[model samples]
Target: MHRRIIAPGALAAASLLLAIPASAASYSPGAPGIGDPYYPYYGNGGYDVSHYDLRLKYQPTTDELRGTATILARTTQDLSSFDLDFLLDVSEVRVNGIRAAFAHSGQHELVVTPRTPLAKGTPLSVVVRYHGVPSAKTAYGFTTWHRTPDGAVAADEPEAAWWWFPSNDHPSDKATYDVSVAVPDGMQAISNGTLQSTSSRLGWTRYNWRQNKPQATYLATLALGRFDITTSTSEGGVPVVNAYSKNLGDNDGAARASVERTGEIVDWLSGYFGPYPFGSAGGYVPDTTTGYALETQTRVYYSPKQFANGSNTSVVVHELAHQWYGDDVSLKGWKDIWLNEGFARYAQWLWSEHEGEGTTQELADYVYASHPADDAFWTVKPGDPGPDNQFDIAVYDRGALAIQALRNEIGDKAFFTILKGWPEKHAYGNASVADFRRYAEQVSGKPLSALFDTWLFHTSKPAAPAARTASLAAASTTVAQPKSWRTIEATNDVHGH
Candidate 1:
């Protein structure tokens, strides 16, 4: 009888109640990839990692690595399952202190299904126990783990974290790190940030390194070997630690001469790019056959080959400048790599000028004239260079040329203002080429769309400015072609990612 007199409002309420279960079932699996065009599966989706605490032990004899990684993150969406970018074998995985179902989706993706669905905006803790020979592992046709004679070093651009630890694994999702590595006694384990302490026990030694500032996963590094470690302080009390492999042989003196100036170069960089962005500043010269250097956060990774031709502080300047442009303010995607390489290269020109080597204008003119209009170098657009050309020399040289052009277009005042202001605006964050263009426009009060297109996006060489030609002529006549210009050219020949 009461049902016969049911009101329309009560019917609506009953209908709403019936829809609750369906609404509760709205949760879905997070995406497997972060959707970068260059490297589709480079990073994971649905979560943003905040911190990573990795406790690792390595035995060089067996070339085996064992580790436990504790990742602190927050879900960005309702997640029934999520993925982490990892390549090693996983022994166990725990989500929120509970064992979760997991499987390897691909070479780099470790898919995890939590026992309970996770709501968006909730904090998550994941503990993963893993053991593998990172040197033996390969993904996407290469390995970031470089096996050394005494020990191993994990240092590579945009992909090293996947080898040493499970992570979100992209510049867009930066997090602080606490890397504690335990190796055999008499050996050293070097990593990013400040070295907290070292303890010895049971024929094993553990080194604790902490990075307080937000850093891209790729910037987290690990070097385990015999190193001659030196410590100092920079201009602003930033602790400096330089490591040189004891067996660097002929390259030993040169490596030391170059990286030992970490404190001075960092202080010099602070003058142009604002204060040093990290609490620690230094670099490690490891004896690896890979003839490349990487800007691994506060502590850069320098191969012995970097100093094969005398002390190369120009490379040092390039990497340290990355501390401001690439490290402090990272790329939103792999495509914006010019934002990292170009500015770093430009810093080398500034250093050359400061050292009476070569003016920025001279170097820019040399690079512009060296690469003819029909050269293949012009075809690789720096702003959106594909994965293959991501680290190409053009991205660095032309990228710097773009900067010189910007300076010419906007004058020294506006250009320098942008150089100092861009990092401050996007400190400890990720930005895109478009973001830089907009920021430049905002700072200079000029539209930079056409300028960016000509210098960054065009598939041909940008035209030399009339003023640049005149300036180059004057520089040629008045300047004696600074010795640093030749150094810049030589360094660029071997500049590696």
Candidate 2:
């Protein structure tokens, strides 16, 4: 996520040469951070998913998932009818351990309703056994292989968690997860949290991962391949595990470096936010052709190429930050994606600060320069589209800038106080822009409504009054050299540090 900085002379020359007024960018209506238009009450009414014990037997030869999911859920409200969204690729289904009636609503979802309604808080357990290959579209970047062209087989993404299990898929409903993934011999299977046990049956090996802490569905991941795993511990004594494909060259050095650094970043972030939100922190570098990485709970998936030139560290920091912002405190809907991306993106600058690599102003200028001053910011209202369109730079970069603006308006002490207080105040929960705005206003004792509206929801970028910009410039001239000022260092050594 980090890019090499341009030389100082080149940056200065470019800054001077490009003094021309920049044009505004357009906007697009996209998905909300959490809720989908299709499922209005997706995460509503807490779900008790403990009744399900899933057994999945994936067949790589035909790219199919032959599995069984036992569901035990209690209703909180009287129901004439009830529905569950089970993301499946094939049509086979059963209920109450029998072949019950079901139908495919669309390419991405399956709808199932029990024959009769149960009373409020009624407990019911149904077993659904299905078989089919999971759709590639379900996965954002990673893939779960059914059958490799070379006869080898692997399953990644645990797409079946959504592809097979019927429950709320959003982060708002944090639930305990127990996953048992069976893979062929010679392949390693990994998932979130701790390794409860491993068992071998037939020709496949079943690796079980049980997470005692509550986790969102998307963060619950699974990967299977011929892996070389290296284990270590952080400075604070937290476990650090790295999983890499056997095909990759000596991963020992890379694994050690990445894990240690990941531990340090986690320690630093926990100091700012709160304790690490999950049970463990690690990275999973699978052998893939893509060039992206994902922050799936405690474990992050990275492409091998990102590690080639040591550019992977930034991605490591970016994803690890999600453990606090995205994973711990989720966005209410897609419209609040800035809640997820902006905070994670800011982690990069925080990383630079921790490394003593750049000044806060320099980082702010870098962000401001890259941000587009246009109506694009509000084009995508929250909860309009879906999750895919939510990953754009506007949500990530511009959103982070808005947070930085807030930090600037309210001194660092109050700003980080809000930041640290959020997850603690609403840990394992959902939050919206309004929730954040109110918290900031309460903490800083400032009427920030104008600022939030102008920066967050307004169509155009907020412009500083001519006088304010002039005053800031004059203030900057009188300040000490930018490089010597340690804003993050000073903030870090506080009580949280």
Candidate 3:
């Protein structure tokens, strides 16, 4: 997710009728939520999803989406009833092939009462059938579904699965997915991971995509529209597939120029962040009014506006960096968003250095000097910016500044080791800011609590180290400005999500 700059401004249940378990005395209802303070109702407790098999059909004419979700999970506790985060009208629900009683209890919860009590540690299969126009369903007074001129795209941060499928809807519960969407034969349905097959019958075509790695529900996405798709292989042999809306107006070439570099960017990023963490890599641009681009798992979502000025590979670099930091090792909760945005924003600075635009220190010094100590930007702590300020510009720019400070304090060898090693240590799972701090200390063999407290936890500006202050002070007195200095800073203007 790319965060826009703020110039002192910013942005379950359970039930069962069937045979009761032999030890039915312990069976109880699952907690309605997973208990994240930021989003208490985001994911349900008592179950851990392992996979989601989604069979869907969409019609552009009516904007109707029909889907059947087969979920595979294990009961963490004996469940008499459980909840699946979802919206839309559910026509039928079955648990273990037995008809289950179901109803909508809250804004997005689909509560189910299975015929039989579910025992702890037992594998379970749940099939849910439903159809609705996603554009018409509103939650939190907004809809993540982007209705386009050709079709629709499902991509957003925090929550998107509720608009399409049913599952554990939080980053903490990562699961593999097999998403199959059938659209008109002339249209295309794009999603995460690699394309397995495409079959057409009558007037509809089914596009099957499989994601073998564990993924958060919000990262699972589907895009249906008329697209011009390109296929290639990266230098590292990673399969690359990119698509663009055929009617992208004047930004078609720029969009392609940026997105087509996915293969090259993935390879370049792998040198620092380790290997690309998914089976395939690519991105898509659909003609939608969404103001931000999203790092949706394997296939990132780019708004047409991202390329309005010209080809913008910086945004691509930010999103692909997420393929490792955000997508592979996700946040344990929303409060740790800096783990995703900070690392991504920092990657852009690294890219600028690689392109001979500016060094990371030069960029960091510029940002640190741009915002005054009295500015509100410094008041929003990146480590635990509350929900309302979660996407504020400070979370990105100031967050990256914190990272640069760490590098300075720990030296090059230990800092780079922590960067590559942190992801490898927590790959395909969720982690918190505290977890990252501990890991960094372990690798650097330094007491970093003071550093983290001053840079991340504190709501006040941190005093600049003498070396950093002298470098920026010297650079400021240079006869000529650094190459691409303005361009690197201008990237903050392009908003993302």
Candidate number of the best TM-score: 3
Residues 1-497 of candidate 2 have per-residue lDDT tens digits of 21111122331232223222222112111111124343333332423444345566655455556666666666555533334545554454544444544554333334444444345666756666667666443433433443223122232221324554555555555667676778777677787877878888888888888777666666666666677786777787778777777665654456446645788788888877878877788887766554556667778766555555443455677778888887788766545666766787778677777777765555655545443455464443322223334554556555666677778788899998988998888787878778888888998999897777655665554454621431222122333443522332222211110
What TM-score goes with each of the models?
Answer: 0.92, 0.77, 0.93
Task: Candidate 3: list runs displaced more than 4 Å.
Answer: 1-25, 465-497
Error of 2 at 441 (Å): 2.1
lDDT of 1 by residue, 327-376 (tens): 99999988898999999999999998999777898787777776767899
For 1-497, candidate 3 gives per-residue lDDT tens digits of 31221111100222233234566767877777787777777788889999999999999999999999999999999888888988899999999899998878657778887888888997889999999999999876677888999999999878888999988898999999999999998999999999999999999999999999999988888999999999999999999989999999999999999999999999999999998888999999999887687889999999888888898899999889999988999999989999999999999999989998888887777777766678899899999988777778898988998899899888899999988888899989999999999999999999888888877888876665542532333233333445755554555644444
Which residue runs of candidate 2 sit more than 4 Å off their true CA positions? 1-52, 87-99, 135-161, 249-256, 370-389, 466-497
TM-score-superior candidate, 1 or 3: 3
Candidate 1 deviant stretches above 4 angstroms:
1-24, 464-482, 493-497
> By summed lDDT, which 10 consecutive residues of candidate 3 come out lowest?
2-11
Per-candidate count of clashing residue pairs (backbone under 3 Å) = 0, 17, 18
